[model samples]
Target: MADEMFRAPVNRSMRTLDRNSFRKVIPLHAARVPENKNISKVRSELERSKDALHQDRLGSVFPDPDRDRAKSGTKCVLLRPGRRKEATETGDNPHDGAEVTSPPLYSSVLDALLEQNIIDLVPYSLYLDYSYWTYHDIISAILPEDELGEVPSGFSQVGHVAHLNLRDEYLKYKHLVGEVLIDKNPGVRTVINKIDDVGEENAFRTFRYEVLAGPDDLNVEISEEGCTFKFDYSKVYWNSRLNTEHRRLVSTFKEGEAICDVMAGIGPFAIPAGRKNIFVWANDLNPDSYTSLQDAIKRNKVTSYVQPFNEDGRSFIQDSAASLLTTTQT
Candidate 1:
């Protein structure tokens, strides 16, 4: 059977979306009810019926656009997918030949409506536009038919930036995917694809990336565990996925306890723990991470409890332990 659902227009050559191209007209079944007090009752019954339309971001009930709301008291409650009836001679009303009998799936609903004497099933032409299609739907439609099931729909968000790790096959359509992501996600203004693996070239866990869409501003501020951290996303390492781990680790530290974070990057661990009055000696080897760590400490107003250091993890551990021991002795 042919697919009746709306799909994105297939146009690999097009960089921007052609709104007109995505327009689709599909036939649906709708029940017209009087504008009386029982209108809500009729609608509720239809909505609970199995044959009611249930599409994401689309409402099942719609006003009769041809009639003025103040003048007319009738509304249309759309049913699930159905066949279209032939239009009348004037081609104005498509409600011709709408009988009381319905498909088996909706027979119970039809009987209830008939008993209430407040329903008239009619044919409706649903016009779906560009905004109707979701990111997965559009990406699946645009990619090659063979690669339809393998659409790259997953991405990591860092503030307003969306980071995608496109496979080798998807690199050619990286820009198109990025554009769709930005259009679908209102909060994301920029999209980038990781060109290299994390920590592949450096111990800082930073990787090279290319901008797929939007501006190249990587400076971002994000809040976690009641603390706000600001840093350059491109220069420092930040993974929102580790938020749970950070929270779990910070919860273990008590007030007035000393924490020596040898590999702290941008103060994800240090700043939150410091908020509880814990003394944290956060250290990192990368100068960029160290700079951002210090900035985060100052921004969060935890400078008195959180101290920033620039040193390798191996040496920082020994130095921090010695300093702690000396402080206790003194």
Candidate 2:
């Protein structure tokens, strides 16, 4: 039987998943080691588990507000799996360092995940998705050996745009960085360097960027978890990496549950939930984000479910949520 999913807002630090922070989650059963080369087979295995908890929780890598403070560039949030049981069982051994056995269901899923390079091999953690690599990995591989230097491991992707914060030494290689990013990542057409810190009015979290390569157009469409979001890269904030989290959050709301999204940027969370027949009271301070969000709600045909507000979140709560709370309680 399935339990109700975790419903609280997860204030996870997006794009700041410390590799050392997560340990591997070994299951109680095991399947034969998957063919690492065939990602499709592994993906199919991952889909077989009917249990939602067995599904990868690594889907939404939320950002940490406190850690990202003073940092102006976009943060790369990675999907990490959630909790698992520690009981030991028997099955096919995984790898040379194998000790414990995983359950039959989890075994195939985990093994397949490891094969696709979709996940990392860490103790007490589930298989990591290897497709999500560190900026260091990308920079190190692309850097020419003749340069003869260590590469800084920091970069963040916001929608189709890759944001980098480079030191003085990297200024010269800015062009190469842009090229490598575009070549390596699909749908990424813009690479920009953050040259300044976000100002006090960080409502949009928008920062000044130096274009390194790719098209000048900052407008883009991002489709995630069945929702299509259209927004301007330069004016509003949108994290495409949070697709899993958006869907995860949406799953928690029972049908027709009313949600109040205070900082609903482009309705990443609001619009999708609305489409599921949930009622939403979404608010955003950024006029552009609010505008795009409305357009998305219309585009997704969720206008009946989402009520957009241009006012600040706090004021919206005071003016609107309070009344709804009383009405619902009565």
The top-ranked prediction according to lDDT is 1
TM-score, one value per model: 0.85, 0.52
Candidate 2, which segments miss by more than 4 Å at Cα? Answer: 1-155, 198-201, 322-330
CA lDDT of each prediction against the hidden true structure: 0.80, 0.61
Candidate 2 lDDT at 160 equals: 79
TM-score of model 1 vs. true structure:
0.85
Top model by TM-score, which number? 1
lDDT of 1: 0.80
In model 1, the worst 10-residue window by lDDT is 83-92
